[model samples]
Target: MSDAPSAPHLSRRVWIMIGAAAAIVTLSMGIRQAFGLFLAPLALDMGIDRQTFGLVVAIQNLLFGLAQPFVGALADRRGAGTIAVAGALIYALGLVVAGLASNALGLGLGLGVLTGAAMSGAAFVVVLGAVGKVVPAHKRTLAFGLVTAGGSLGQFLIVPLAQGLIDAFDWRVTLFVLAALVALVIPLALGVAGKPPAANHTDGPALKPALAEAFAHPSFWMLNFGFFVCGFQLAFVGFHLPAYLRDGGLSPSVGATALALIGLFNIAGSWLWGAWGSKRSKKGLLALLYALRGLSMIVFILVPLSPASALVFAAVSGFLWLGTLPLTNGLVAQIYGLRHLSALAGIVFLSHQVGAFLGAWLAGLTFDATGSYMLMWIVSIALALTAAVANLPIKEAPLVRSALPAE
Candidate 1:
C-alpha cells in the first residue's frame, strides 16, 4: 500500500492554517454547545414545552449531519475557505434570527436549518480536510486533536459567557452576542483558502469511485456505527443534563458550571487522546473511550445527585467527550487517503448526527411522558458497549485499490 501525503516540517504557514481552522471551530462549536443553556428560558418564554425545544435542536443536528456530505464534496472540489466564509455569514444570520424568533417556525428556520447548514462548512469536516492535506502523516492526528480541543475551549469559555449574558440580560441578548462572536470566523477562514496540494490534486479516485469503495467496505460501516453511539451519548447529556439537574433540585448555576467543567476537562482529553492515537491503535483507544464513558454514566446516576457528584460526572464525562472526533477522522484519512476525505468523513458524521437527533428528541419525549431520563441513560450505556465491540473488527491498514494508479 502507498503512504498518504506527508510534510517534512511544520512550517509557519501550516501552524497559521491550523490555528485559523481551530479558531473557526472554536467559534462555531462553542456557540452551538451552549444551546442547552437557552432551553429553559426559551421554552418558558415561547410558551412551548421541552419536547418542542428538543425537536428544534434535533432538527438542527439532523440538518447539520445531512448537509455535511454535499458541503464537504463542494469543499473538496472548490475550496474550504469559500465554504467557510459563506457558513460564517449564515451562522451569524441564524443566531440573530433565533434571537428575534417569537414562534417555533422562526426558531426552526434560524437555529434548525440555517445554523445547521452553516456548521457543515465552518466546523470540523471541512476544516480538518484542509489540515490533513498539509500536515506530515505522523503529526496529522495530533494536529487534528489540537483542532478538536478548540471546540472544548469554546464550550468552556462560551458556555459561561452565555450563562452570564442570560443572567445579566436575557437569552435574546445572549444569542445576539454569540452571533457577533461567531462572525469572527469569516476572517479566520482565509487561512485554509486553497484546494488540495498538487500531489493529491493530480492523483486518487474521483468522488463517485471513492464513495463506491467506502460503501463496499465493512469497516467503514463499523466506524459509522461506533460514531453513532458517540453522537447518541453526547447529545443526550449536552442537551438534557441541565434540565435533569433542575429536576433533582439543583440550581441553574450548578448546571452551567457542570457543562463548563465538561468543556474545560475535554480540552485535556481531546489533546491527550489525539496524541495517543498517533502512537497507538486508534481503534483500541476509541473502544476504551466508549467503555469508560459508559461506566462514568452508570456511576453518576447511581450515586445520589449532589453538586459534588454532578461536578465529578462533568469532569469525567467531559474528559471522554469529543476525544472521538480526532481519532475517528484520523482513521478515515489513514485508511482511505485524503483526496476525498471531507466527503467520506462527512458521510460517517451523518450517522453520528442521526444518533444525535434520536438522543435529543427521545430524551425529551421520555421526560415529557415519564418525567425522568432514566430510560435514555440506559440506552446510552447499551449503545456504548455496542460501539466498543463494533470498533474491534476494523482493519487499520489502508485499502489498496488495484485499478487506481499509485501515488
Candidate 2:
C-alpha cells in the first residue's frame, strides 16, 4: 500500500498517463484481437489446413510470451517509453511484412516473432508498469482495470472494423491499414515516459531479490498455473471459434460479430472486477471468473448451434474473457509491490502464452486428426475448472513486508 494518495481526486498528469497508456494498449491489443479474423483468409490463400496456420499463431503466441520477461526487465531498468516506441515500430513492420508474405516462414517471422516481441512492449505489461508508476496505490487496481478495458474496447471496435475492411478489400490491404494504426503508439509513448517507480530499485535490495522472492512463493506458481488456463482458453477460442462456427454452418461475419461481442462485454468485465479487486478478494473473484468460464463453455457445448446461441455465448464469454487480468495484476501489485510489477507480471504472462501456444496448436492438431474441436473444448472446460481450484487457496496479501520502510 505504498503511495496511496490521501485524497480521492486524481491529478491531470495521472489522467494523461492513464489515457496514453490505455491508447497504446488499445492499439497493441486491438490489432492482436483481429488476428483470428485472418486465419481463414490466410489458410485459403496458402492452401494450408488449420494445423498449419495454427502453428503460426502458436509461434506468435509463444514468441510474444517468451519476449515478455526480457522486455519487462528492460522496462524496469530503462523506461517504458523507449520500449513502447520500439514495439510500435517493430509491430508496424511485422504487419507490413505479413501483408506481403507469400509463405509460412515469412508469416511466422513477420507475425510470430517480430510482432509478438513488439506486443510485450505495447500491451498490458508495459502500459501497466508505466501507468502504475504514476498512479497512487489505492487507485492502482481501478487504473489497471480501466486500462485493461481500453484493450477490450479496441477488441470490441477493431474486430468489426477489420471484418469490414476484409469485406471491402484484400486481407493484405487490411493489414497495412492496421499497421498504420499501430504506429500511433510511438508518439503516445512520450506521454508515458518515466522509469519504473524508484521503489522498484530501492524498496527491495534489488530486482534480483524481488524476482527471487516471487519465484520461491508457492502462490506465485499457482497464479502462473491458473493464468495458463486463461491463455489456453482465450487462444483456443479466439483463434478457432470462428472456424468452429463455420463448421456449424455459421457465416464468417458471425465469427467476426462474436469476437466483437467478447470485446464489448469484456470492457465491463475488466473494469468491474478491477474496481472490485480494490476492495474485495482478488483470488476469490478470479476463482469465480474461471469457474464461470467452465460453466459457460459447457452450456455452449450442450446448446444447439445457431446465430442466437453463438451471440449469447459471445456475450457471456466476453464478460469472463479478461476478468482475470485486473485481478491477477492487482494481486501482483498487492503481494509483490509495484516496483517489479512489469517483471513479475511478465513471467506470469509467459505462462499464459505457453498455454496459448498449446491451445492454438492443440486445437489445430485435434481438428486435423479427429475433424473436430470437441477434445479441445473439453480440455478448455477442464482447465477453467482447474484454474478455479488453483486460485482458491492463494494468499492475496502483500508479501514483501521486510523491505517496506516503517512509517
Best by TM-score: 1
Instruction: Tell me the lDDT of candidate 2.
Output: 0.87
Q: At residue 361, what lDDT does model 1 achieve?
A: 89
* Range of the 10 consecutive residues with the lowest summed lDDT in candidate 1: 1-10
Residue-wise C-alpha lDDT for candidate 1, range 273-350, written one tens digit per residue: 888878789999999999999899899889999999999999999899999999999999999988888899999999
Single out the weakest 10-residue window by summed lDDT for candidate 2: 1-10
TM-score quality measure for candidate 2 = 0.95
TM-scores for all predictions: 0.96, 0.95
For candidate 2, the per-residue lDDT at 374 reads 96
Query: Model 1 Cα displacement at 405 (Å)?
Result: 5.4
In angstroms, the error of model 2 at 329 is 0.9
> What local lDDT does model 2 show for residue 101?
94
Deviating ranges (above 4 Å) for candidate 1: 1-9, 199-203, 403-407
Estimate the TM-score for candidate 1.
Answer: 0.96
Query: What is the number of backbone collisions in each predicted candidate, taken in the order shown?
Result: 0, 0
Q: Which candidate achieves the best lDDT against the true structure?
A: 1
lDDT of candidate 2 over 230-319, digit per residue (tens): 999999999899999999999999999999999999988887877777777889989989999999999999999999999999999988
